[model samples]
Target chain A: MSALGSIVPLAFGALRRNRMRSSLTSLGVIIGVGALIVTVSSGEGSKAVLQAQLATLGTNLLIILPGSSTSGGARGGPGSGKPLTHADLLDLVAGVSAARYSAPVDRTTTQVVIDNQNWLTTVYGSTPEFFAIRDWTLARGRFFTSGEADSGAKVCLLGQTVATQLFGNGDPLGQVVRVKIMPCEVVGVLGGKGQSSQGQDQDDLVVMPWVTFKSRMMSQDRVHVGSILISALSPDEVSHAQSQAMGVLRQAHRLSDKELDDFTVRNLADLAATQEQAADTQTGMLRNVAAVSLLVGGIGIMNIMLVSVTERTREIGIRLAIGASENRVLLQFLVEAIVLSAAGGLVGIALGLGGSLALSAINHWPFIVSPGWVLMAFGLSMGIGVVFGFYPARKAARMNPIDALRFE
Target chain B: MSGEPLIDLKAVTRTYLTGAATVHALINVTLTIAPGELVAIMGPSGSGKSTLLNVLGCLDQPTSGSYRFEGREVATLTRAERAALRLSAFGFVFQGFQLIARTDALDNVELPLVYADVPGPERRTRAMDALARVGLVGREHHTPAQLSGGQQQRVAIARALVNRPRLILADEPTGALDTRTSIEVLGLLQSLNHGGITVVVVTHEPDIALYASRRLVVRDGRVISDDRQRAHDAAADLQALPQKAA
Candidate 1:
């Protein structure tokens, strides 16, 4: 057989010579790569799931809130100091070039009594357009018209939790719920929403006409005003929409050049943009961590090869003293190191792909399976073999025949 | 001597640099061995006879002077060039047998061709031929660890002859064998010599040396004696040596 053929048998021979050591070395690589596979795939899948949820916050949606009154109480960064408000929303609707829709939301917390049961819920009051903007669909009955909202109509909608708590499985679309000394007829029941960021069952909240909420229920003069929710005709117009909304709010708040406005605009696009940036950062870190694991695998390869060199010193001497060239000996050992790491890489790739698949299947999450990354990882493994395995191979090649023959 | 000058060493020197000092292993040795010759190198433990054989086998380079193999100056050859020179020109049977412990007899014999890049079928055929020549045709699959010491040395000799090299350098080939095996090993070397392959066997025993047509004695890194006999037959020499000694 050719000298190269000997490499195949010799590599196996070395492994057979010390099966335990070889197994232990490979075990390290397997563990490192396995953990890396799970972590990377998990991180990628989680990011995808979060992005998908964020996308449900439609591009045409905007929220108007009681601009947090921190004008003199501003304690954070410049733009973050402002809160979104209703006047800002009105002005933005009248002024923003990109804003195609806007909504002003007002709400209160009240204890409602029905029969012997008492339930506390948020009462959101807004124009009927709020449904289209917030992407909320009514499960029964109907939302009040804009004129009814302006005229302070006595109509209400029950959130999912309040409906279940009060009505059980019965229909309550036309029933009346007493909202703390005010009786408003239920006009609609909102589809069940799991929960909100503030730990309120979004299903449990009630809704009413904004004018009625302001004129009949709320006694505050300015009414919680600052938060503005806006939606552009398309997702891409968010930047222009943001600037236009800012200009109108600035004009209404009458901000001077030295003064940063006391209001902000938050839209679906903004939330999506920040989330995408975060995803990018997380994905990059995951890749870096995986790279480190592969590097550790590389070190394991080099370390085992060196041990093989020491163990096979006499064999190397015998070959050299016979007729083998130094290069041939070196090549034999080099090929051995590369084959080991490459094999390990192949196994790691399969495991990594399978791990990604399992995660996607069980969690219903999205993952990017880039063949480029797999190929890069495999190539890196081989590179590790060549770069790290060189020193040991050379030492084996350079050994003195007489000394090696006498080695115990 | 057949007047062939198969290997010629002129003013050769080999030096070893240990951690603290330069050690001269061989000093200014000049010698020539003719074709079909059986020569033995004899020396005490520290006499450098092994080092001399190493250089002659082309496993080592001399620090000074010239070594010519088949009239090609060895000192002038590159590492690969010397590998080529060693492949077709010299065979080594190390003192330890150095039979690549895990490899079988046939595989051990095929090592040279492996370097020569010979194809698989040819390598197997040639290796088997060498094993049969060494009377181990049926035992080609036995590893060195499985075989007796004499058999291991015989495998080593088969390895040496597999490439059909011109000169065989055996360094204490029978050192570990029993007396009977040693005699058998020496007889094998004699038979190989009779087949016209030059052989150089290194040992410390006079009996092993007596098997050769010529004996060179070395002391303290220098050759002290060169003795040649008209005919070499261990059976005849054992009988004749007593009279010569008296």
Candidate 2:
């Protein structure tokens, strides 16, 4: 009686007549749509998980790496370039508007020995403020104080992994481990930090007062330390703080106007943003490719429907002679095509959702599915049926009744 | 005999091209049939009998000539308009019985009304009545495959009558049936003609043609003779005349 009701029976009849062919056609759309769904969902999920990890590093932190005359080399330039000095740090603390907290760290890779056991680890020479800058915490005792650091106290804190390795479930507190010639007492144990995506152990390190490590242990006048971790008040002030810190350091270094800046900046927030953009681009690209398969599936339906038209030529003529209008005849075949594609789309959506959901467990990652993709796949299939099915439908509708009656 | 001609054709010509060759299926044909007339169009193979039925039933457009159906000139009718004419003014009983396969008798009969946008209840009621009139009320749910050839033809006839068309066009309606079943179908068609419905049957068999009161003999594409004969039980008596005469 209505358009919806009329098409239902017609579509149903078509599907009933060709069960296996219809299922096969739908399988094509299912695989294409499912692949795109899994790709975009997993991509988005990975991006979210990665960003959450980056957030734990503190969005406010800015990194400053150690190098001599511009990022070219660690080799000293001109008159033997000095390591990041306290004068440069103190000037920035006094002059910069956005430096809420900053620390100049002295870092190296060295082996610490206890009896016959020796652990190769990254050693940090830092003030107490370094913990606050990197958003780290102590698992056991206390960090070295500012006074202790300034006074060059020969005490150190073992990272969780190093302590566990050397202490063997026994207390590392009040115990002493050898670092080069000096034996440093373990005053604290830092919390466990697991491996990064790059597979490096975060807890395989030790921290000491900057003064004790810099002057007494290494004894070299020039420092080739690693990164100086700084934290700004807010993420909005990071760019400003960075520039102000850079300007203060450049004036302190007295570089020529033609010289390009030496150090590399690793802003976790910016890194997260760039990765998000790349994921979005990849999602779009994958979705487009998936849509092409939907298009191909539609074309397949048209091709099959065209064959069906020839096979059913006499049937169409019978309908026409029995008083079916051209529009009615067209609608019959069109309904058949649409029913096929829509069925395919529905099956594909289920398969895709199941795949992604199951993949979340199999791969141990988050899975996400968007409703928009499902709707799009369905609409695309229907559109393909209508657009591609028009020609054959027209041919069927225009068949001569006399010739059709005689068709064998 | 008393009423106006329900169909009038003036020099209708229908042509079709097969690759490079042209087929003059029907040419220079003028014919007229009034209400309540029982007419038979008799012609051999390749004589354009089916083509003539297509034109007469408004299922085709003549390449040249005028055709009036129920007082309307249908020479240039659009496909939709011809479909409407088929729905409202003419019903067809095809040679193959042409019942939609896998569909029940009632569904087959109700199909044309579906396109006419007839409401479901009224269509069902009228289709049932038509099937009952053709002695197929018990077989309304039977598909063509499940029914005998005679029963299938009766369902097709019921489908033809469901629209209450002014003209009933039977194109070899009994070709697929036995001699006994053909008589039963021809008897029903004659009864419908007796009820003031215009009936036209196209048959090459003289025995079949003898059942109709009026006959048009076709030679080539043109009508060679139009004559009236007394009603007869031609299928029973025709054994004396040789099948070649038919």
Candidate 3:
């Protein structure tokens, strides 16, 4: 231990004698480590942002859209087939054991007016179960009741955008708003949900009872819904719920074994997984590039250490003649290399953190600092020092004291 | 003189393979150095004087023969063991005054003790004392470039003395200094010898060899003559030289 203690100062003194060369040699490590930190932390930040956006859609959510229509060998795209009905939603909830909540939805776009202020927005007609499936809660007042939905009462709930557009900062609940020519009373105001994964504003719509919407707003068939939204009991049950819903719908439609599904069920969990995988691939590529740069940096260290060994041959001879052992000489050079690379690693970490903070602020992403990655980067730099330093140290240690002292 | 000889070499031979040519650096040379004796090995270039000094210092092993230092067989020791023996028992001074560049005198003197694993405070005290013994008390902080050639040689001598080794081996210790400075350095070595440290000096100049009590002349890798003579007083010689004009 005392030998190591003495070796450290000797190493430092040698490095200090050639400050410029030492700094330049470690520059490669600095850039490599800095780039690694920036790429990894920013990758994590983007991934977090994407996950939060996905979460805003709902928990264990699934969307079932109507399949394509076929006529005279001509096929229309999805949502052009025989529309799904409220009965199909009811059958799915009853048949699928994993199904937690389900809602039948019909949508239309129209202008809404409160007094003299008018704003164009999308309107959704759904039951009270829609709020549960979407994981939505009211900011004020209460959601419309099932009685109002079944009785086809002209009551509505306002999304934050719609409320802001028509009422400004005024109380929106209990106020009356006109959808086209029909007036409806606002029962509640939904809490804000920001932009979604597809960059669409989720808070730019109004929701009302399905009975009132089919009768008064949209001109579609009264019994058929545009789509069905379902939530599974847990994240792991989403695929099971989807398969169960498909079976239930196929049986309800009386389709034969040879027939294709009349509706398409999409598991949002799968979509999330695919997006997360893409993020991981991007992060992995950047990490590999950073690793290559670090390798180049290690090579640079080795090159400088070799040159330093040659330059200090006479010094080695003097030390050896004064009773320094071969291991002592080897330790001295190895310590110098380690100190150089480790110091570079520290500076790189600081630079990378600063770069990540700046990028997050500029791009409006959450700042995520992964301590494990930082430690690994530091360990990698130190390992490079040891691996690259050994050959030169060994060369110096094996020198003949007579020849070395005579080295011109 | 009653104890075993400090160094014993019996028919030692060292050869070099220089690109398929066998060069005999030392050929069947047998010699012994008693404790506290000042000996000089004199020869022209390529006569194996340096090689003999290297063998005695344990920096090189004989190609074939027994080399015993303080009654211990040096030929059987490993490279690391030889290094440890040198560290504990030998000090070396070179022709170029091989002090590490850019380091102060005190640090150069402290070099050997650093490998000895001496603690910091004690190493400093001993280094300072060694420097003061060489009459370099106020020049402890001067680097090799900052000090004169004579001062640099003194720093090298101080480094050799700092380890308190039993033997000091100097190969042309005054090769780079002037006449008066050479006498000063020889005076220091003679005083060290008087203080019971064995000294072996390798030089081609007969004047330099006159400072030692005994001399061995070498020719063609063989010792031709060995003689015991009264050594000149380096202090008296330094006093007799005329002072330089300021």
Best candidate (score: TM-score): 3
Error of 3 at A256 (Å): 3.0
Q: How well does candidate 3 score on lDDT at residue A131?
A: 92
lDDT of 1 by residue, A1-408 (tens): 356676777777766677777666655455545556666677767777666565444456655433344546665542354554555556677888787777777767898767777798887767776777667778888888888887888888887789888888988878888987788888888876554323445576787877777776677444454244677778778777777776776777778879855654566656666877777787677777777777787788788898888888899889888878889888888877777776676677777778878878887777666666667767866787788778888988888877888899
The pairs that clash in candidate 3 are none
TM-scores of the candidates, chain A only: 0.82, 0.85, 0.94
Better of 1 and 2 by lDDT: 2
DockQ for model 2 equals 0.67
Cα lDDT of model 3 by residue, A210-264, tens digit:
9999989966468788899999999989989999999999999999999999888
Ten consecutive residues with minimal summed lDDT in candidate 2 chain B? B237-246
Task: List runs of model 1 lying over 4 Å from the truth.
Answer: A1-5, A60-88, A111-119, A137-204, A215-226, A267-297, A347-368, B1-4, B19-22, B230-246
Q: Residue B114 CA error for candidate 1 (Å)?
A: 2.0
Candidate 3 has an lDDT of: 0.91
Top-down lDDT ranking? 3, 2, 1
Ranking by TM-score: 3, 2, 1
Model 1, span B1-246: residue lDDT tens: 355498899999989999899888899999988887899999998899998998888778899999887787897677787777888888888778898877788888988988888888999999999888879979988998899888898898989888888899999988888766777777777878888899998999987887888999999889999999654565444444334223
- Of 2 and 3, the candidate ahead on TM-score is 3
Model 3 in CAPRI terms: which quality? high
